[model samples]
Target: MRMKDKVCVVTGGSSGIGEAIARLFAKEGGQVAVVDVDEANGQRVVDAIRSQGSEAILVRADVADEAEASQALLGVTQHFGKVDVLVNNAGVSAVGDVAACTPTDWDRVMRVNVRGVYLMSHFAVPIMRQQGSGTIINMSSTIAVIGLQARAAYAASKGAVLALTRAMAADHSHENIRVAAILPGTVYTPFVEGYLKRHYADDMEGAVETLKRRQLNQELMTPEDVAYAALYLASDEARFALGTALIIDGGVSAAKVF
Candidate 1:
C-alpha cells in the first residue's frame, strides 16, 4: 500500500476530484479526513470508504473561512495524530472575461479557490513542520498556464495557486515538507457538468464532444487520473518532487490549436 497508515486531509472531498482523491487515498491504506461544506455528500463519502473497510471521517466546514478551516485541521489532527498529506482541492469557477465578469463573481471564485487553499495550508503547515515531514498538493489547472476564454477569474485564482505552491515548497523544503500542484486540463466532474448545463444547455452533448476533441489526446481525463497523480506526489516516492507542477492535461497544454 502506497499510503499505508498515513493520515491525509482532503478539502472538498465530498465530490468531484476531491472525492476521487479521498477514496483513492483510503484504498491505498491511508486514513482520510474528508472536509467539505456539503454535509450529506461528505457523510456519503465517509460511509462509502467505511463500507470498503477503510478509515475515513467527515469534517463539514467551508474551507474559505479561517475559523472553520482551522477547526477542520484541529479535528483531523486530534483524530489522526498527524496529517501526513494535505490536499487543497476545494475550488470554485467563475465565467466571463475581465470586462464581462462581475466583481462579486471574481471575489466568490477567489474566496474558494485561492483563499481556501491558503487557509487550509496556513493551518496544516505548522503541524507538518512539527512532525518533520509532510506533503501538500494544491489543485491547480492548465487554464492557469494557458489562456482559457470566459474564465478570467478562475485562471487568475489557479495562477495564484501555482505561485503559492512554489512559495510553500521553497519555504518548507528545509523541513522535509514537500509542496506541489497538479494541473489537470478538462476532467468530466460535476463542476464541468454544471458549467455545461449553464452555458451550453441548448446542446449539451455537442458541447461535451467539442471539449473531448479539444484535448490533444482526444479523450477526457477521469477524476481518478488526477487522483493517481496526487497519490504519487503524496507518497515517499515523490519526496524529491518539491515545487513541481505535475501536469495531467492529456497533452492539451502542449498542443497549439492556432
Candidate 2:
C-alpha cells in the first residue's frame, strides 16, 4: 500500500501503458482518476478498477487543450479532494522525417507531448505546493535519447518532454515537488502493436518480430513493466529522485544494438 490514501491522476488512462499504471496505482491504494477522451474505453477501465473494489473515477479530457486539462484536474479535486501524483501520459504520434515533417504535424505533437505536460503541472503544482509535497511523472520514450527511422518528430516531441521534466524538477525542488520522466523502450502496448501492424507488416507475427528486433533484448517490454517503474516514481520510495530521465528500453538506448 505504498500509495495508501494518495490521489493519482493518469492521463490517457483508457488503455496501454497509462491504463496499466492506473490499475496498479489503485491496487496499491491510490484513489485513481482515469482521464481519457474516449468515454467508452475510459469507463471500461474505471469499471474494471471498481470491480476490484478500488476507488477509481473516469474523466474525459483533451489534455492538449488547456481549458480541458484544467477542468479535468478540477473534476479530480471535486471528487478526491486533491491530487498527490500527476502522470502526463496522453500523447499523439506523427510519422515523418526531420526536414520533411509538416509544421502542423509537429505542432500537434508539441501541443500534447509538451504543452499537456505543462498544463497538468501548471494546475497540479499549486495544489501540491500548498501541501508541500507531490510527484509528477511524464511519459517519454527511448527515442528521446536515440535516433530511430520515422521517429524524427516523435523524438523531438519526447526530447522536449525529457527537458520539460528536468526543468520542472529544478523549479520545484525546494518546494518538495518531484518531477521525472520515464523512457520506455519498445513496449507492447496497444499503441505499439497497432503501429507495427500498420507499418511493419500486415501479419501480426512479422510485425511483432520486426519490433522486437530493434531491441537489444530481442523482446518488447510489456505495459506492466512500465507500470512498475511508474509505481516506484509515484510512491514515497522515489523521494530523492528529481529531474531524472529513467530509461527502461531493454538496453536499446545503452547500446548500438538498435
Candidate 3:
C-alpha cells in the first residue's frame, strides 16, 4: 500500500479522471476524500470505495468558490485529521479563440481552472505546513504548452496552473511540501465524449479518428492513465519529482503531424 494511512483529497472526484484518482488512492490505503459539487455521483464513488472495503468520504464543494473550498478542506480535516495529499482536479473548459471568447466566458474558465487551484492550495497548504509535509498534484493539459484550436481560455488557465505549481514548489519545498503538475493529452472522459457529440455531430467518428491520429500512438489517453500518474506524484515514490510538469501526452507534443 503506497499510501497507507495517508489522507488524500481529490477535487472534481465525481467522475472521469478525478474519480479514477480517488479510487486508486483508496485502493492504495489512503483515506480518500472525494470532493465535487455533484452529491449523487460523489456519494456513488464513496459508496463504491466503501463497498470495496476501503476508506473514503464524499465532500460537496464548488472549488472555484473560496468559502466552499475552505469548508471542504475543513470537512476533510474534521473527518480524517489531516491532509497528506491534495489533487486539484476540478476544471471547466471553454471553446473559442481570443476574439471569439467573451469576457464572461474567459472569467468562467479562469475561475474554475486557475482560481480553483489557488483556493484549494491556499487552504490546504496551511495544514500541510503544520504537519511539515504534504504533496500537491495539479491537473494541467498538453495544450498548456502547445497551441490547440478553439481553446484559448483553457490554454491560459492551464498554463497558469503549471506556473503556479512551480511557484508553490519553490515556496514550500523548505517546509517539505511537494508540488507538481500533470500534463495529459486528449483523454477519453465523459466530458470529451459530450464535446465530440456536440461539435462533431455530423462526423463524430471522423473527428475522433482525427484526434487519435494527432497522437503518435493513435489512441485516446484514458482517465486511468492520468490517475496513475497522480498516484505516483502523491506517493513517497515521487519524492524527488517536485516542481515537474510530468507529460503523459502520448508524444503529441514531440511530434509534428503536419
lDDT of each: 0.95, 0.90, 0.94
User: Model 2 over residues 158-222: C-alpha lDDT tens digits?
Assistant: 99899889989999989999999999988888787778767776588887877788778787889
What would the TM-scores of all predictions be? 0.98, 0.96, 0.98
Order the candidates by TM-score, highest first.
Answer: 1, 3, 2
RMSD of 2: 1.4
lDDT of 1 by residue, 1-119 (tens): 99999999999999999999999999999999999999999999999999999999999999999999999999999998999999999999988999999999999999999999999
Q: Per-residue error at 31 for model 2, in Å?
A: 0.6
Overall local distance difference test of candidate 3 = 0.94
Looking at model 3, report the run of 10 residues with the lowest lDDT sum.
249-258
1 or 2, greater by TM-score: 1
Clashing pairs counted in every model: 0, 0, 0
By how many angstroms RMSD does model 3 differ from the true structure? 1.0
Query: Pairs clashing in candidate 1?
Result: none
Which candidate has the top score in lDDT? Answer: 1
